[model samples]
Target: MNKLNVLFLTLSSMENINERGIYTDLVRELASRGIYIHVVFPRERRLGLPTELEIIDNIKLLKVKTGNITETRFIEKGISTLTIENQYLKAVKKYFGNINFDLIIYSTPPITFERVIQYLKKKHQSKTYLILKDIFPQNAVDIDILKNNSFIWKYFRNKEKHLYEVSDMIGCMTKGNVQYILNHNPYIDRNKVEVFPNSIEPIDRNNISIINNEIKEKFQIPAHLTLFIYGGNLGKPQGIDFLIRVAENFYKIENSYLLIVGSGTEYETIKNYIDSRHPKNVNLIKSLPKKEYDQLLRSADVGLIFLDKRFTIPNFPSRLTSYFEYSLPVLAATDKHTDLKNILIESNSGFWCESGDLDSFIHLAKSLADNNVLRKQMGLKGRDYLEDNYDIRKTANIIMKHL
Candidate 1:
C-alpha cells in the first residue's frame, strides 16, 4: 500500500498537544502507526512569540500564531476566530509549501476554515474529512447564545452550512448526531455523513488501581463516603448553575461526596456557591497535570457527567474516557438528545438521567453510593465496553477506509 500523508487543521493550541484531549490522543495514536502526519495548531499567545515549528512524538507540528483567543472575552474571541483563516493560510504557504498531502482532516469550532479547507482540497486534490464535533448555529440557538434572524446568527448559520457542503465526508460523533445532521440540513447529501463516535487510545488497566490511601488522605477525602468525581472544563455549556444545584442537593447526603476538578468561565460561580454553602461533602480542585489528574481519577469511586438541559445539540464530553480508563462507573446527567443513555444501559456500564431532574440524579447517586459491589461490577463493564468500542485504532481504521 502507498504511504498516506495527512494534513490536519485543528485550533487546539500547541500548549495542549501532550494533554489528554480529543485530538491529542488520536493524533498520537495515528502518528505511532507510522503514517505521515503534519499537524497545524494555534501558537498559544505569549507576548513576543512568533509562529514556530517543532516535532513531537514523531509528528510534525506547526504552531501558527494568531490573535489572542481561548481565554478572552466574547468580542475578542469572535474577532480572533473570524480572522484565523488568513493566519492559517499564510503559515501553510510559508511552512508546508507545495507538499501535497493525500488527505485533509479538520474539526469544527470556529467554522471559519471553509476557505482553507477549500484551498487544500483543490490544491492537493485531497479527500477532506470533517470531524463535526458539534452542530454550530443551532447549538448556539439551543442555549440562547445566538438569537435567530439576527446578523450574528445569520453569519454563523451560513458558515455552518458552507462547511458541511465543502467536506467530502462528515464524521458525526454518534448515530443521533448523524441523524440530527441529516434531518436538520436537507441540503447535505445523506451519503456524505456517517457515525464517527469519539475514541481514545486504549491503555492497559491491569496494574492501574485506585491510588493508595495517601492521595485520599492528602486531599482530606473521607474514607467512609463514596467519592464521585467530575473533572473537565466548567462553563456555561456544562450547565454550571445546574451543577451548583446538583452539588447543593448532595450537601446533606453524608454517604455521597462530590469532587469537582478543573476550571473555566464559571469557575468563580461554582467556587462562590461552594463558599456560600460550605458543603462539607464536596471538594473543589483546580486543574492539575494529566498524570496527576489520572491518579486522582483512579482514587474516585464514580464519574459524574453533566450537560445543560437546554442543549438541543447532542453534546458528548470526551471526559467519559477518563472515567472508563479508571474502571469507574459513570452517572451521567445530560440533556435528552444524546443517545448516551441507551449506550450506557446496553453496555450495562452505567446509568443516565435527564439533566434538569434533581430527583433522578439524586436517586441514582444514592443507589451507587449505597452499593459498593454494584459500583465495582458496573465499573468493570464500563472498562470492557471502552476497550471494545472506543479504542482509537478502531476509529482510525474506519476513517482510513474513506481515504
Candidate 2:
C-alpha cells in the first residue's frame, strides 16, 4: 500500500516537541500511521533565513522566513505589519515546489491562508482539509474584539467564508463547532463538515508515578495543602480575572493552594494581581517543561479549566487531556454549553460553575479539598473516560478511515 503524502500547514511554536502547540501531536500521530508528513511554519526570530528545511523522525519541516515579528505582541493584539500570506506563498513556491502531496491539512486562526490552500489544490490536485480549531471572525464578534456590522467584521467574515469554500473537508474539534459552522453559514456544504476532537497518546501508568514531594518542594507547595492547578494559556479566553477572584475567595482556607503554570497576554495581569493582593494560597509560575508539568499534574489534587462566558464557540481546551492523563479531577468553570461541562458531568470528573461565579467556584473548591474519597473517585472516573473516548490510537483509526 502506498503511504499518503500529507502536507500540514499551521503556525507552530516549535517543531520537535509537543509543549504548547497542536501540530506536534498531529504530526506525530500521522507519522505513526505511515503518512508522509511535512510541516511549513513561519521563521523563528533571531534565526534569519527566508527559507530553511530540516527533517525529524522521517518528517520534513520547512521553515520560511517571513519578516521578523514578535509573537508576544501579536498574541497581545499587535497587528503584523509584514504580510505573512505573501511570505508563506513565496516559501511554498521556493521550498516545496518539488514535492507533491496527497492531502493538504491547514489549521487556522490566521485565516489568511485560504488563498495558499487554493493555490496548492490548483497546483497539486490535492484534497484540502481545514482543521477548524477556532472560529475566528465569529469568536472576535462574540468577544467584542470585532463589532458586528463593522468594517473589521465584514473583512474577517469574507476571509472566513473563503476558507470554508476552499476546504474539501472541514474537521471541527467538537459537534457544537460543526453545528455552529453549518448554522451560521447555511451556504456551506453540510456533508463536508465533521468532528475530530483533540487527542493524545495514552500515558503508560506503569512507567509513570506521581512525584508529589519533589514537585511540592520545588514550587513551595505546602505538604498539607490540596493543589489545584490551571496549566495552560492565561489569556482573555480563559477569564484569568475570574480565576483571581476564585483565588481571593478561597485565600483564607487552610490546606488549599492554586497554582497557575502557564503564560499568555494576561500573565502579567495575573502576576500583578497575585503580588498586589499577596494571596498566601495562590502561586503563579511561568510555563514549565512538559515532563515537569506532567509530573505536577500527577501530583496535583485538582485540575482547573476556565473560559470566558462570552466566547461564541464552545471551546474544549486541550489542557483537559493532561488532567485526565494523570487521573486528576477537574473543576471547570465556563459557559453551560461547552462539551467540557458535559464530559465532566457525565464522567463524574468533578464540578462545573458559571464562568465568573466566585461563590459557586469557591464552594466547589472547598468541598473537593475536604473530600479525599470523592476526589479519588472522580479522578478514576476521568481516567477511565479518557481511555474509552480520547485515546490517540482510537482517533487515528477514525482519521485513517477518512483518508
Candidate No. with top lDDT: 1
RMSD (CA, angstroms), candidate 1: 1.7
lDDT of each: 0.84, 0.80
The segments of candidate 1 whose C-alpha lies over 4 angstroms from its true place after superposition are 14-19, 46-48
Give a tens-digit lDDT track for model 1, residues 126-172.
89999988688788788777798789999998988888888999998
Error of 1 at 254 (Å): 2.4
TM-score of each: 0.95, 0.93
What lDDT does candidate 2 reach at residue 72? Answer: 64
Per-residue CA lDDT of candidate 2, range 1-403, in tens?
Answer: 5868888877655545455334676678888778888888877555765477888775888887664444266433324323677777878788778888888888776788888888999999998888888788777677676789798778777988998999998988878888988998999999999887777787876655646578888989887889999999887778877888877776755689889999887899989988998887888999898878878887899999999888868788888877887888999999766777877888999899989888788888888999999998998898888888777777667556666
| Residue-pair clashes per candidate | 0, 1
Model 1 TM-score (2 dp):
0.95
Top candidate, metric TM-score: 1
Angstrom error of the Cα, residue 150, model 1: value is 1.2
